[model samples]
Target: MSTTDSTATCECARAVAELREELATLRDEVAGLQRENAALRDANERKAERIETLETHVTQEFATIRERTDRIERVGYTAVGHAREHAQWMRKHDRLHDALKSRRERFDERLWDLETGEIDVQDVIDAGTNDLPIQTRTKERKTNPDALRGNKKRSTFIWPEFYARSRKTSGGNLIVTTPDAANILAEAGVKHDNETTKRAMRFVARLSGNRDDPNHEEHLIRFEPGERGKSPARLVADAGEFEQFAREASGMDVTDSENDETDTQDDSDDIVGAEADEQMDTLLNATTEGS
Candidate 1:
């Protein structure tokens, strides 16, 4: 063979070897790039999931905040309405305050009308007088309401016969124990059923400031731990709490309102004076401006 032809063949083989090496390097680079792309996709998916979770949590938190705010506003508005109504009643009843002999003035003068009582207890109950569960006595002054009353303070000194009365001048509660109170009610009236004791207990409990009940403000007498909780016992009266509460209702106690009159009086706002037209003629007088 010629020398030139042999040289050309060697050069061609060397060129082919160089091309093969270049192809192998290009394949390695492509594989590395594919691995990096897969890693990037996985990272993006994780970030998206975390964002969605945060959004859901924020939405729930905002909803909870709105609900609590709405509840507070409702309570505030209701209180304002009640206060306005209370003041209106006070103004309206003053129309006949100047009569020579008012119904209440006569309760003070029990001369000829000895047999006819000052107030009809049944009529008062039937009229739904603030829906109170308490049954106070008018024994002593016969005209006086109870110990809770300001001018009639000496009244209710002798409590109901059914209760275990406490004649303590320091003024303790007139109580009948939970079981005793229930048994007595059951035996007294044949109109009640098997659930009479339970119903009566709950009714009294709710009105007398049961902690769980929403009507904690309507505490006419004062009791604790209604039928729901562990201490299912009943309380007939808490003299101190009742005295303070009744005085507040009749617009007598205002020392607490001295600092910020509007705020404190508003805070203590509650509906009263529902016992007027129910033959409890003195109730309006007691509710208006007490002595």
Candidate 2:
């Protein structure tokens, strides 16, 4: 054979060997890529499952929250409704109380007139004393030897004036609001929000016995302490509490249990009533430190 033909045949065989080696390497790379792709696909499926679980949990939580909120709203609405109902009932109770009080007053007045031929001496005293215009009224001439100035005419309120006013104005079934009471005191030269009003309330704290029988001016005024700084005060009467307490304290109480009868406690200052200033002179006997 020729040398050129032999060399050509050798080159062809070498080229075939090189081509087969490259094809095997490509197959190995493809098999590795396929395994990696399968692993990635499995991981993606797990992540999808986790995402679905989270979504379900969030939905359930939202539903529970919505249910609880609805329940709270219902409870709030119920509470509001009950409060309104209670307010209405309270108003009704107040009206009934006023009607009954007026009727009782009328009956007492009638009975007293029939029994004694006139109004009670206390009423006469209250009316006569309270008639003075509040602006011009002065304190009763003091007889206190220890007082700094015994006869100095100063603006003050004592039991007599308050008793007189309260007696005269009570129970046309008058429900005196704090503003109304303040106005009454203002006419007597008292400031609406001053310490004098508080002092007057304290002075009358011992007068709770007025609830049982109209003696000792206990029933003349009942000071109710409520919402002291926040709202205007309201008046409330404790039925038998003050009367019972007074009985227990004195060890012996002289309450008028006698039937509709007028008794002149002191005829010296008769209920026929002289000048208001003169009547107050006799009031020295009623004065005390507690007052």
Candidate 3:
């Protein structure tokens, strides 16, 4: 218990103090590491939330874009259909114009003859210019006994050649039936189902004044009941009104009335047709621009 003992006690005390200090430093380092790990976990959670939000926004935007694209495609198809219809209308108008022009030329020739003393002007004016009728082997019986004295019979239809040429080959008498209406409607790019065809037939019958007088075969149109009552009655357009009625069936630029004396009517019709064409072009251009 002398000097050696005193030195050993002092060394032991110093070692103990050093061990305690090392343990404290280790605890501090562990605490700091735990804090850093917590902060990193919070940052990762926030990043995950942000990614989810971005994904949702992108999904919604994509859906909106898809819907817009579908709408645009439907509109483009509709525009194309309208354009086709307008083209058909223009063709019909051209045919009418040609027919009218030919008639005018014929009248001019007659006028020239009168001016050159080749024919009397009054006689030419008085002469009827009715179109030739369809030939029949058997003469129709007269309805009245008093009016049956003459052997000669006259034609009921006096329409232009264009309408007469369009007559159905199978019908006993030339006329436009429901199938004919459907065909004409199809040419104008319109869907001609049963309902639409029937509607058009009724409209034509009403317009032609044939509905009020069903028995009269001289009207512009005639509706005949099915033989043996097996099917619905069918409509037949008069040879005179056939072409005009076909145009009307399309429900385009045609009207029930026209004033030939109006100065701006033709110009207005042309402008309307042009405007329709321009609208179709605009729709196509918009589709191209989007692409």
Candidate 4:
């Protein structure tokens, strides 16, 4: 009703209006925050679902991998077992082959002795000459006059003296009949007189076919002296003679057959032996490494 009272009323009205505006602003901020919180909660739920799906897929992949690994392990174990079995088989085969080879060797030696007089002389002869004849002076002259002219001829008188001085024929029992055998004997290159006779006796004994008779014991061929002191050519001739004698005595041709069989057996044994050795080495290495 006075001027001062009116001014106080006006101030109160302005304050009330300001307070209402501030409350309205606060309400709008609260509404915006609530909307943001609801959107965040939805996004979090979607992320949780995606994470669960990813975990399931990873678990399935791991299970598949584990299954495949188990199968591979089983296969590896089976392969190792098979390898061991094969190794054992190879060892057994090698042992049997060796035993059979030994038996075959003994049988061959006995059979060779039975068929021939004592040794497989045929093999020695076959190795030496191939059944070629020994070339003689007369044969050479007949075959090639130029060759005959180039070579010198010794006198018949010299032959007797040479024979007499030779150590091979002490009592004239050793004869140089075959031209080949005679050439072989002369070429032996014996220095000592006693050695010459001994060499001659050995040559003659090889030539003579009296191995079965015991009365010709002194005439028997001595391999040791000739084998030790003889030249390569003489040794070859002697070997040929022995081989010829063996072939004549033995009615069967066993050399080639025996060689073929021996080669086959050797190949088989080599393969088996190699496999067995590898297996043994593997086992030994494993043991050494504390496997």
The lDDT per prediction is: 0.44, 0.44, 0.45, 0.41
**Residue 103 in model 4: lDDT:** 70
Error of model 4, residue 109, in angstroms: 6.9
Stretches off by above 4 angstroms in model 3 are: 1-26, 118-291
| Candidate 2 TM-score versus the reference | 0.31
Candidate 2 lDDT tens digits, 72-157: 99999999999999999999999999978976975674475447432233333433432221111222222332232111111234
Q: Give the TM-score of candidate 1.
A: 0.27
lDDT for model 2 comes to: 0.44
Q: Estimate each model's TM-score.
A: 0.27, 0.31, 0.33, 0.33
Return the lDDT, model 2, position 207: 27
Question: What ranking emerges by TM-score with the best candidate at the front?
Answer: 4, 3, 2, 1
Query: Of the candidates numbered 1 and 4, which has the greater TM-score value?
Result: 4
Better of 2 and 3 by TM-score: 3
The per-candidate count of clashes, in order, stands at 0, 2, 0, 4
Give per-residue CA lDDT, model 3, range 31-72, as digits (tens). Answer: 999999999999999999999999999999999999999999
Which candidate, 3 or 4, has the higher lDDT? Answer: 3
For model 4 the local lDDT of residue 49 reads: 93
Q: Which candidate is the best by TM-score?
A: 4
- Determine the backbone clash count of candidate 4: 4
